[model samples]
Target chain A: MTGVSGGAGAPRLLQVAGLSAGYSGEDVVHDVSLHVDEGEAVTVIGSNGAGKSTLFRAIMSLVTPSSGTVTFDGNDVTTTATHRITRMGLAYVPAERHLFGDMSVAENLLLGSYPRRPDPERLAMVYDVFPRLAERRNQHARTMSGGEQQMLAVGRALMSKPKLLMLDEPTTGLSPLLATEAYRALAELKAGGLTIVVAEQQVPLALELAQRGYVLENGRFTLEGTTDELADDPEVQRAYLGVA
Target chain B: MISALMDGVVLGLQYGLLGVGLTLIYGLAGVINLAHGQVAVMGAIVVSLAMEADVPAVPAILIGLAAAAVFMLLVDATLMRAVYRQEGESRILLGLLIMLGVGFVIDGVLEWRYPIQQLGLRIGGEPIPILGVPMSTGSLLATAVTVVIGLVLVVFFRSTALGRGVRSVIQDEQGAMLVGIDPARVRTFVFGLSGLLAALVAVTRAMTGPVGVSSTISFTILALIVAVVGGLGSVSGAFAAGVLLGVVDRLSSFYIGTYVTTIILLLCAAITIVARPAGLFGRSH
Candidate 1:
């Protein structure tokens, strides 16, 4: 169990205790426990196939946990449906960036705000975050470049005005500049007091923007500390940062 | 010629209504409902029975539509639910076979109970002359109803949240799930709506001309042709193709012979498949 306190008396916004999730009766995520307090940005950094995505999916209720309890904002949500979990102010931006290719960018953004009324202010905020999206609001999402689509995916998740936003591999295929821009957006969101949980293979960027992070290997948390501590850890450097 | 053209337009609209339901179901649920025409027949049977029992035209039609919708909901819940759980070719093949059996059962039951040769609505009014062509009150009313239903569907898909949710499912099922749209609920709603549209077609047929129990197969074939010609999932494409085929059918039957009309329709469908396999308006996947 890794307890990164939010503040002196801040309430815990999310708590996962003994979560064991899997596919086809075989456990992949084994007895993982973690917590995120209010106004915190946490990252789970791992290599490919380390089960980081599965952990996030379990948290979003997209995948059923074989055994565990997930408490979000003081309510048990381990067995809840994915949409219900989303409606409860937790938004997930999946890795595939599953934008309705035929639908316009504006329509995709509008769908993000589906759990609540479509607010013009939210739309404006999303556009403000990604000015290129504003320029191509009426364009089909499929026609956009990879970087723009990533931006759109992040912006779409933000439209829901969720208390906790979980993004899976937000900068996976972006150019160096675009990845920086994405991290900049995340930093901006974190600065705005939005709690975020990001699962990423991009170790340095994830560590840089997140206040605290967990190093995950084989579906288990290997190390947990503040970003500075993890960056300074010799084991993390040899494996993730390519430093010996 | 003008009267034939006008009649063709009306018939085209009816075909569009009939095909739209099938298109939507296929587009969203990926299920080809072989029971579609039989469901319409069931609705027609209800209307006919209600009329025989002294029910008024409006109420009888409404009752029939509701019954068809309810029946489809049952079909979706009981049969299609299992079909959807399967994957790939198995899903398609199983859906076809199951719905085919369902259609046959419905047809057999209706034949056994009703035993009626033909049924027609008893709409009372004088023929109205338009551009020197006399159009019956019933035909005009059916056309008007078709147009209204089409408009309502357009608005529903464009403006309503539920409708948007359905579209989202159509585009990407997993993505829709992530955004909190339940695909199962959307599927059920679409299946029910499809049945309601078929029921509307039955009522329109009863109003404009006699609808025999044996005509279910013909109606299904016609609707399938329209859907394919228009592009299976595009509503506007289906409507346009229905109108085009209806006009072509009427013109060919008049100029050549009734036998040649079927040949021409088949040729149109074949050409469309060869040229644009996705149908006229369907996005090429």
Candidate 2:
């Protein structure tokens, strides 16, 4: 079988086309399309209530798309169950970080490899990425501080050694210092050749970590370019970079 | 008094087993199985019928447990399919009504056809002394089995990957899904396990006294009290509540009238709900 690896003209690792999804017959995310290539980091930058979460949810099959298609690693998976999509190497860490609160940090990480035995090497790698998780391995996820919990969420997702990692607002409740620290870890993961698609209100951090970026405004991609090009755009600068 | 206390302990273990099934189902599915006791009785009756047909006790008990498990799996696949489709309050309400209806149907059938069917296991041996109280061989054996099963459950939940997957679904279903664990599959498995557990309790209880079709309602009531007092969905909590309530049951029956024991137990449940809605060992839902 031909894999999704890219040399030239190969299928992208993930492709979403004409996706419009919402709740109760009301469209929250209008017709939107995006793609991520193998071993590349891409970011979708948008503001609050801009339907970023809705787009991610649709891609994960958590929210049924009213009309659209999602192809992942050469398979059309628009209507697959969330768990099946997850097992297909798409790991998502949402803004709210739907963590198993009653479970210990270690337990949560262990369950990241659900229906499969957790590899010790992956566990150690997560511990290396977030040493705080290593320290509080026995502590319940609910008891950890916001930064620590975020770290745990990311670490837990990494436990699967997923082919693609998508995180929505990973720095939601962290202090500025912790936010940068979280980004630093993401940078490290990207450098290690993990494919990443992160949706963020923290545009500068996301742009710095990603090679290319998409500007999602009002539930549509208003602009898409290399990080350098988008960073130079005055509209992007004024709106997302807090520059006048 | 010592003998009563010993009997209470034995009775409490059985109660804990009974409640564990109901609580596990509720914890994972957000649906209380009101037909839990009826299913347990159905298992007991199956065993009795097999024994009446000259089947050996061991094989008959195994067949009874399998019958109950299969029945629950069928229910999960059929009526529960609709119930699981509903979410939040509607789901809980629908599940309750359907299970209650199932309970009525099973109870009606059992009483209509097997009015005289009862399971009474006779373990011939001298009474064993525990804590200076003479305990019947059946009670001692049942207690041993319950304790062993309890330990196995604890280990399974704590150490096994599939078992932890069950707890993950209970803790946060969305999170479980993201981790590639299907909540629907987990619910179905737990529901079947609950049925097997319910049947197992019936088998153990028969060693002590006759388990008759008429005892269905009482078993259901006892299980409800145990689940409430222990905190629904908490295994350790259920066992803790069982022991405490069992002792209370015996002490009240000894000191007060036997007719009022159920009322007193119900009162304890009421007090628990009023004081701690999450239960003694449960997280607030």
Candidate 3:
């Protein structure tokens, strides 16, 4: 909440207040609240099953929130349909990376601009970001390696030119080097003025990319601070930073 | 021998068309529409009544197709609303039961009201010889129409934005939504298209023989088998399976008997399912 104000004049781009969402009418993430201002990079660091995915799903309306509200770019989107929310400039890349397995890489990227024709500049930008996608444009997405598929997922999200991009555990299966490379790309996107919210188990990489972060433990945010503060916190170091 | 093979190819094209309609709807909506063939019969009844009222052949066929399309759109918006609300197995089962009831109602009404009504399109012309077999004008026309429509559908699913959106929904529903493609809209559109394709198959079938109320169940069975063999969601697969099954149907009928041909066809579908559960083109999850 400290960085909810994007400077003095930049309005808050995304705000979630008291959101409690889960599957089967039972709440997994309870009364969670967070906000990311325009052009800011925010991270939610948590262990497995910490409800990070649930929170993001709640924001996207993939799962109905038992209570609370999500406001994006000044609109109440608590009950908005998932596709409608995406159309309103909030793109999400889930941990599963649900790419169309049978379709080619080019088709997957092309579909990212749904209802709107693919913009040449945006397509070029995505290909520039992940050149492997360009090389395998005609190859089926199912055939791509795990790291390549992750790249395609992020590339697809970027194709929409969204105002705020949310990702859940983007480094779930990547090698250490590839995970670092993935963050490097994200860092470049942040440098290019993109607003991002990433939920990650990898605290070091996430802290490096995000300016501020919230530590989520078992469905609630237990701590909130700038990246520097989070990196130095004793609990965060012991639990996530691997610092004895 | 050549004649039977050629006729089989012609019939196979129509089967391909029918399966594609059914396959697409199942892929997108997760519903196996039991009322599909009955709805097609309803459209044929519309065409027959339109022709009785002095409407020309082509316009009457167009009106019938539109009627079927509109009827399906209505069903998708209204009756299928409850079905769409459910998830996974319940969704599919509920849709099946609802559509079955709709089918029974349509069958009862059509049989009671128009017991003898049938659509028979007779294309009067010389039998054109091709590849050593003389082909009837009606068969040729049906084949031509089916081929053109098939090619159009392939291009649509392969190239067009709306078509790709439909495919995207079938492939990964959540991913489709994240990309701003509404699964509901895609389902509705595909439902209407399914109805139209079903009616189109009826019209094409009428070229060879009369399509009456009795043809409804058989049409549904054929569509189901073809769709299953075609992998349930692949358009090109439907056509390929249709063609292969069509040849089998004709050859079996000629060499053995019409009674046994159906059993053999059923066997083919069963074997396809047992051997390759995903059908020929469906990707295994």
Q: Pick the candidate with the highest DockQ.
A: 3
Clash number for each model: 0, 0, 0
lDDT of 2 by residue, B1-285 (tens): 988788888999889889899888999998889999999989999999999999999999999999999999999999998998999999999999999999999999998999889998888999988899888899988899899999999999999998999988888889999999999889889988988888889889999998878888888888889999999888888999888888889888998868988999899999999998878998775
Worst 10 residues of 2 chain A by lDDT: A1-10
lDDT of 3 by residue, B50-115 (tens): 999999999999999999999999999999999998999999999999999999998999999998
Better of 2 and 3 by TM-score: 3
lDDT of 1 by residue, A115-152 (tens): 56789998998888889999999999989999999988
- Model 3: which docking level applies? high
Q: Which consecutive 10 residues in model 1 chain A have the weakest lDDT in total?
A: A1-10
Compute each candidate's TM-score over C-alphas. Answer: 0.94, 0.98, 0.98
Give model 3's TM-score versus the native structure.
Answer: 0.98
Order of all candidates by lDDT, from best down to worst? 3, 2, 1
Better of 1 and 3 by lDDT: 3
Interface RMSD of each: 1.2, 0.7, 0.5
lDDT of 1 at A225: 91
DockQ score for model 3: 0.91
For each candidate, what is the lDDT?
A: 0.86, 0.90, 0.93
| Ranking according to DockQ, highest score first | 3, 2, 1
Scored against the native two-chain complex, candidate 2 gets a DockQ of: 0.88
Task: Give the per-residue lDDT of model 1 (tens digit) for B118-220.
Answer: 5697678899998898889998989999999999988988777787788888888878877778888899999899998998898898888888678787777
lDDT of 3 at B130: 96
